[model samples]
Target: MISVVLPARNAAATLPAALDSLAGQTLDDFEVVIVDDGSDDGGATRAVAAAFSGRDSRFRLLSRPHRGIVAALEAGIAAARGWAIARMDADDLCHPDRLLRQARHLDANPAVGLVSCQVAFGGDARAAQGYQTHIDWCNSLTSYQAIRLGIFRESPLPHPSVLFRRELIDRHGGYRAGDFPEDYELWLRWLEAGVVMDKLPQTLLTWNDPPGRLSRVDSRYHTEAFFRIKAGYLARFLARINPCHPRVIVAGAGRITRRRAERLLDHGIVIEAWLDIDPDKVGKRVAGRPVLPWDAVPGPEACFVLPYVACRGATEEILDRLQSRGFVLGQNCLPAA
Candidate 1:
């Protein structure tokens, strides 16, 4: 059986929608565990209560003080009785077949310790904040490629989309709070411990993009903490993947990419070149590498592309062009150095 965990805090406005989606799921062999974090809005608790009122024994609610998301998720994980644990967010909605599909994938591929699926933007779909592009870019990655390309670093597997083995969490100890990012840290641990993770080729989750969310209310989600968390793991993984110091090429000569190039150069990885499609940046130099036009670069046999930003369309377009010229990604190319 599958156990679905939803950790909520002041999610009254969106909680009902989240629970409704789960209630409509085609798979009924799963249980719902909602951990209510200390919520001033009180919507989370109300939503949980409504979801369980006169319902079957499958739904369970656990309440706790506002000790942050890690603590809440820990409570839900501890209460979960199933061998497989799936994650759902307080505000996001799951597809009707999400659990069924994820469970089947895990059962069929025993080697996979965790699985996630494609997610589309909900709430407000017209926001030009790159949601459409993000969906397109995220869906392009295969299950193996997502895990191999340092998935946590280059736009994580989308936390709400994951359904992983409970044993994996027990062995590593469920989510921890503080300076480290929870999901990214867990993904790193899975990689370090050699736990395989896969992604299904279908969209199974809908991300609710609402105004005044925690990510926007509190800047923690967009802070330097995630960067540090990602960078540490990326360094360790890259060192393992390219022991001999592979030839590196960085795209987008921006501040972020320039800093990344500096970090690699400091670590003795030869910078093959810097690239940019902007005419103004085409002839400049950054971190001692000549900034060349995108098409001027040599093959990946002698270089790996490390684009700075997650400009999904631009990145994929460049990747396709480079890939067509016999560049195998992960082995020869990487994203966001």
Candidate 2:
């Protein structure tokens, strides 16, 4: 059986549609565990869940006080019965075959600890361009190695579209509560622990981008928090890959990128050089590191390269240059955002 964990908090506006989608799934061997995290919308959220539970025996609702998402998720996970724990949000809609496909993939590929799928973003037509770009970038990472290489660049998998083995979560101590995005932190932790993760190429979820989403309002998902998380994990990953404590070369000479790279210094990562295409910044020293031209970047035998630029097109160009120079991704070079 597959246990679907749906966390809700004042999600009355879109909870019904989400539950309805689950009810319409092609797979029948699944249970939905809805954790109502203190929704105060006149008990509307509870009413929705109650109605669904009455209609479908597989649906169950667990009401709790106003605890955060981490607590709600932990409660739901503890109550789950299936070996495979699938995640769902109160506002997202899953495709009819999402459960069947994901469960089958896990059954066939026992080595894969977690699997996510492509997502279709809904709401706000004006903001579609940015969301589309992100979706495209995420879809490009279809293999385990590709996902790991791009993990630090961004959240390579959509949280709501993922289905993972319960054992993996148990071994990692479950979701961690901190001053950073919980989903990203969990993925980073799993990667650090050598957990194999991959994403399906097909879009299996409709992700709603409402203005009041937690990511927009919560300080934990802020830009600085993401950078801090990335720097911490990147430093540890680099250290593990390079036992000799080789100097790290950061690509990009912008102030913002430099600021993010500087955070790595606090983690004991030595930033020995910076690679840039700009002639003005070349030969100059920034943050005690000399900014060198692209041709001057150290080879794989010397230092590890991290592409710190955020521009997607420019990042691809930088990656091409690194690859041409015989730098292997996830080894001597890793892309960063």
Candidate 3:
């Protein structure tokens, strides 16, 4: 059985659609554990969940005070009875075959701890272009190695689309409450603990990208917090791979990019130099490190290269260039954007 954990807070407006999608799933052997995280909608959210519970015996609702998503998710997980726990947000829609496909994949690949399917963005097209790009980039990383290599660059899997093994969460002590985004933090923690994860190529979920989403409003999901989280994980990963603490070369020279990279420096990771494609920026100094042209990048034996570039095509170009130079990815050159 697959337990679908749906955490809702002030989600009365969207809960029905989400619940309806779950009720319509092709896979019938599943339970929905809906945790109402203190919705102040005058019991409207509870009414909706209660209505679903009345109609579908598989749907269960749990009420709790406003303790945020981390706590709510934990509550749902604790109440879940399935071997695999699938996540569903109140504002998103799941494809009918999502659970069936994901569960089958897990049944076939027992070694994978977590798996997420590609997502389709459902909102204003103008505001969703960035999200669409993110979805596309994330979907490109379909293998465990690709996901691991790009984990620091971004959240390799969509949180709501994920189906996780119960043992995986239990082994890691469950979701952690922190000043950073919980989902990203969990992924980082799992990756740090050597948990194997992958993504399904099919888009089995529709992600709602509304303006008032938690990620947009919560300070904990801000850019700086993400950077700090990335830096912490990157430092640990680099130390494990290169115990000698080689001076690392950064691949972007922009001030904001450099500032983010500075977090790693604070963790005692030395910066050997910076690399950039700009002719004017070349031969200049950034944060006391010389900015060199692409051709001047140090060989794999000398130092490790980290790409901090965020441009559309630049990351692929950088990866190709590094690979062409015989610097194996995830070994000597890792993308850290």
The segments of candidate 2 whose C-alpha lies over 4 angstroms from its true place after superposition are none
Q: Global lDDT for candidate 3?
A: 0.89
TM values, all candidates: 0.84, 0.95, 0.95
Among residues 3 or more apart in sequence or in different chains, the pairs in candidate 3 whose N, CA or C atoms overlap within 3 Å are none
lDDT of 2 at 65: 96
**lDDT tens string, model 2, 1-337?**
9999999999989999999999999999999999999988899999999989988899999999988999999999999999999999999999999999999999999999999988887766566677678877888889999998888888898889999999997698689898998999999999999999978877899988877878878999887888888888888888887633647888998998999888988889888888998888899997787999977776777778888988768788898999998988877888888
lDDT tens per residue, model 3, 1-337: 9999999998999999999999999998999999999999999999999999998999999999999999999999999999999999999999999999999999999888888988888877676777778878888888999988888887878889999999987688778888888999999999889888978888899999877789889998887888888897898888877633647888899888899888897788998889998888899887788999978887778778888887777878988998898988878888888
**What TM-score quantifies how close candidate 1 is to the native fold?**
0.84
Model 1 stretches with alpha carbons more than 4 Å out: 42-44, 47-54, 150-153, 223-226, 243-247, 260-273, 277-285, 288-299
lDDT of each: 0.74, 0.88, 0.89
Clashes of each: 0, 0, 0
Global local distance difference test of model 2: 0.88
- TM-score ranking from best candidate downward: 2, 3, 1
